[model samples]
Target: MPSAISRFAKFAAIAALTSATVFASLDDAEARRAGSSGFGSRGTRTFQAPPVTSTAPAPAAPIERSMTPRPQTTAPATAQQPFGAQRPGLFGGFGRSMIGGLIAGGLLGMLLGHGFGGGFGFLGMLLQIALIGGAVMLAMRYFANRRQPSYGAGGQGGSFSRSNSMSPANNSSFQIPAIGSGAGSRASSRGNRPSDEIGLAQADLDQFEELLTDVQTAYGAEDYATLRRLTTPEAMSYLAEELGENATNGVRNRVSDVKLLQGDIAEAWREDGQEYATLAMRYSSIDAMVERDSGRVVSGDDRRPSESIEVWTFVRKSGADWKLAAIQGSEQRAA
Candidate 1:
């Protein structure tokens, strides 16, 4: 009886230990999810910029969000007329000529007798009038065709104008270079030129790095005010929600040692008088979660650092400070 009781007690102890291990593992996984990068949402999930090489992989599916603003189209300027009015229409210039032709034809027919010959006089007068009227109509049509504007070969007539607006001359030839071929040279040339096209400078890149650190630090501290100022309203909402969930679970996410490893501009553009830039960044940090009351680690390695790659987009109005607009995970990370 004693031996049987001993075995039963040992079995119960083993089962209990196994169960505790499993639950702890689950808790750690959940904690990692709570503090993971790419937790917040912003902008459309679909990739909109031109493709570029990056350490991060492409997203398996497009994100769900509204698309960013696009450039505003300006209406074409109206061409000024020499006399400050529209040119005369076809009948406006030929009305008198047409009237004269009709009068002359009638007079000629009346002058001829009603039966000059054998009842053929009236028919001959009618024929002369018809021929005169047809000649006048043909002349009018010819002049109208001449006055019409002519479009050059290969020109489409809809919304696009035939004349090149960017060039000083009326016509210009623009060639787009193939991607990955002479791209560096083209980029250098564009950098040299003065245009409205968006391009990131060294200072702008530095600011991006700074923002990455600032955002993570502020998030770890649960600083809502700073987060609101640094991120867009949409992103702010998401971060707040995640932080709330952590609080409800009685855990606090802690992040530190945030370091940017590598980064490059995925794309940049100006739209609706605002500038936007998306950057692919590989960074490392120490992320962990601890119990609020006991300060016991619930998940993650507090001593070791982890590396993650993410794509972040920033937006700003002209002459304004840039703010975080969106964040996406690299191929291997889950949002």
Candidate 2:
């Protein structure tokens, strides 16, 4: 036995080395466990703690959890696709919507025809507005663009009547008035005073009959040139345009059943050393259409005899020679 102090020192040194060796061994074992089975422990043989280790909290339990496969959330998304893309009904589309609205309104009107007082029908209201408004607009536009027609006495083919020209005789049977003959004096007084009244009343009446005969003859013969001579320039132009249109459209109008109803001089006056007289004549005729190619009468407005009244004015350059100046006629269409 050495000194007591020396002996105590040697014992302490040996105890210290033993504790360090135990610590080193525990670290090696923990590393091995962490690398392999992840959780391993060693028993303590003495009063020393098992090991010194970092106190890092154990990795949080994996956030992933067991799934119950809830009522197919993804399946619901697929089921909604077809319904979202489905097309609309016909009446719901833009182009056909107006037609649907009209039909619906009409049907509603029919159902409520008796319910509403005074026969207020939906379709009737719409139709009335359309027709009336359209007619008014058309009439306004036409009147705005048109001027009144003017008439006067002018020479035929820019020349005076010739003495040798053959025409209906004066004082002849053809010269007789169609209406009450000599009574023309009593029918239309030339002057307000009884004295200056000219016996031209008979002459005026005769002039009317002649004018009508002239028109009928010219129309029958399709003598457009002679018709131009008898009618005003405006009237002539209108007829020519009508004929041109008919030709372009390939149509021919036929006439028949010609009858003279009445003829009388409406007025008579003297202008520039010439006698000017206006005649009123009434007549009836049947108009028929003929095919340009077949000569067959196809269609016409005068299936039933149509009546017309013509107002004609004539001028005479000399005593026995007379020619038409202005002529106007109105033909009412048969219903």
Candidate 3:
């Protein structure tokens, strides 16, 4: 019933209205978001919207943090020591080494001292001094005099006889022809006879033994000063050197089996205004065990009871008692 041209116009107008409605809906959503942020004008078109924010939040400021110190950590199972303990220091190790070295040095010193002769190399000299010292002491005790001539055996001034069978002047077997003094006559006659004979008083023998005992005690005690006083200077020095060695090596000597077999004054003579007496003695002795710190021995038959001969010549100076001048020892001359 309607004209064709009117229908066409109506259809076009409907299409235009539909497009406008869709545009409006989209604009409403934008406006809602802007209003919440105060960016929208009053009375702007409003509509429901999906949840939204007007401006993206400023990207979170990059966090700035620092690492902090931590407590000691536990050691791994493979470690030998526990946690927090430290190793030994340089000085500690050095101290241990020094202690070990000192111990080794001391042991070596002792071995060298005892393993070799005379106690050891340096110690032998000391032992020699001790031996000489002990020997001299025994000599002093045993060989302090010589035998006096028997009354019936000689015409010496110190002899007296109580028998008529032997002539009172001189025994037939012990003749001393009177002679005028001459150098040749004295040399052939007096020199052949003993220079002189002297008797040993019991008191003299006792005193000699006492002095000798004192010397022996000193030697046993290693008192070198006493030994020097009782013996000659040369003898003292010899002994001192030996004692020094003994101190170094730690060895000592002892003499035993001393017997005063015979002792008497050999002669009372004057030479250069000095009086002297020659004494002869016989005895037996042996080297015995004394000390062995350095580990040595003087090997021989020390207790064999063999005799020895000793000759001790003495000199007396003004204001001084008799002192030993020289001494001689002989194993073959025993008796």
- Looking at model 1, the pairs that clash are 45-63
- List, residue by residue over 1-335, the lDDT tens digit for candidate 3: 43563454344334433433333243234323221111110011111110110110111111011121223558795778743243432212453345334433433443344311233433353353345335433433332211111111111111010001211121111112112122213333324223332333455445454444454455545687777666555445544554565456545545454444444333345555555544344444443333466434543233454343343445455555544443332222332
Candidate 2 local lDDT, 1-335, one digit each (tens) = 33564454344334433433343343234323221111111111111111110110111111011121213235563465543232332222452345434434433443444311125444354454345335434543344234211112111121111011112222222223332344333433433111111235555455556556565556544569987876545445544554565556566555555555554444455545666554444455555555668766555443565544444445665565456554432221111
Q: TM-score of the candidate numbered 1?
A: 0.48
Worst 10 residues of 2 by lDDT: 35-44
lDDT of candidate model 1 versus the reference: 0.52
| Candidate closer to the true structure by lDDT (higher is better), 1 or 3 | 1
**Strongest candidate by lDDT:** 1
User: Which sections of candidate 1 miss by over 4 Å?
Assistant: 1-52, 65-197, 333-335
Q: Candidates ranked by lDDT, best first?
A: 1, 2, 3
Instruction: Indicate the TM-score of model 2.
Output: 0.37
Task: Score residue 153 of candidate 3 by CA lDDT.
Answer: 16
State residue 318's C-alpha deviation in candidate 2, in Å.
Answer: 2.0
Error of 1 at 7 (Å): 46
TM-score, each model?
A: 0.48, 0.37, 0.35
